[model samples]
Target: MSTSRHLSAHIDRPVREVYEYAADPLNTPKWAAGLAGSIEQVDGQWVADSPMGRITITFAERNQYGVLDHDVTLPSGETVHNPMRVLPDGDGAEIVFTVRQRAGMTDDDFARDADAVQADLHTLKQLLER
Candidate 1:
């Protein structure tokens, strides 16, 4: 069965600030090192050169609700949906990333994925609050 793990970080920035920053695909290379070593916009899509090879990121339409969902298409042509959101929290905001465990993946792999997401979130928080 497929499963997903949700990880989050509290950033000391307003919801709009956090959402706008994260929603911009260009910022992926700054905080998501584990996913993309380098990312650039190409043909209206965010193309990433990652350790896993070249992949493309397609983000959802920008809106006022702080939704930052996107899809990652691997070199294998398999696409994975990433659900992320930024929510207002007092004077700051909470950023959440949902990590979906791929089919046939082992527990160790799932754990590593979660850890990676956590690390990415921490990195994003540090970058924003710096």
Candidate 2:
């Protein structure tokens, strides 16, 4: 029971197209600044450098239902599960990202995180539409 927000962006692309592109972790850094720099597979695990130091990123197995949920383990060993999905909306698609306010997060911190997620989703839409 925490404060949560579902930030979304509408993309002018098919659901399958959006899902395929986003389901790939390599494409993350191109749009999402949260992961920052680059993502590489180290010792069979996806690792990325972030403002919070190096972190481990794991994505849910690719599926037909457009479930793009992923788990991000911070350097301090805290794991945050991010729920994301691409759903059909008319001829295009809608990308939804759920951001939940975590423990110790102040109201300002939560708002900042939500803003970041929205910007990331907007980037995704721009990338796909072009």
Best by lDDT: 2
Cα lDDT tens digits, model 1, 33-122, are 878989988887889998679999889899999998989999999999999999998899999999988988898998998898899999
Q: Pick out the ten consecutive residues of candidate 1 with the lowest summed lDDT.
A: 43-52
Measured by C-alpha RMSD in angstroms, how accurate is candidate 2? 0.8
TM-scores of the models, in the order given: 0.95, 0.97
| Pairs in clash, predicted candidate 2 | none
C-alpha local distance difference test of each model: 0.91, 0.92
lDDT tens digits, residue span 18-122, model 2: 999999989989999866578999999999988679999999999999999999999989999999999999999999999999999999999999998898899
Please list the residue runs of candidate 1 whose C-alpha ends up more than 4 Å from where it truly belongs after superposition. Answer: none
User: CA lDDT of 110 in candidate 2?
Assistant: 93
Best by TM-score: 2
User: Which sections of candidate 2 miss by over 4 Å?
Assistant: none
Error of 2 at 40 (Å): 0.3
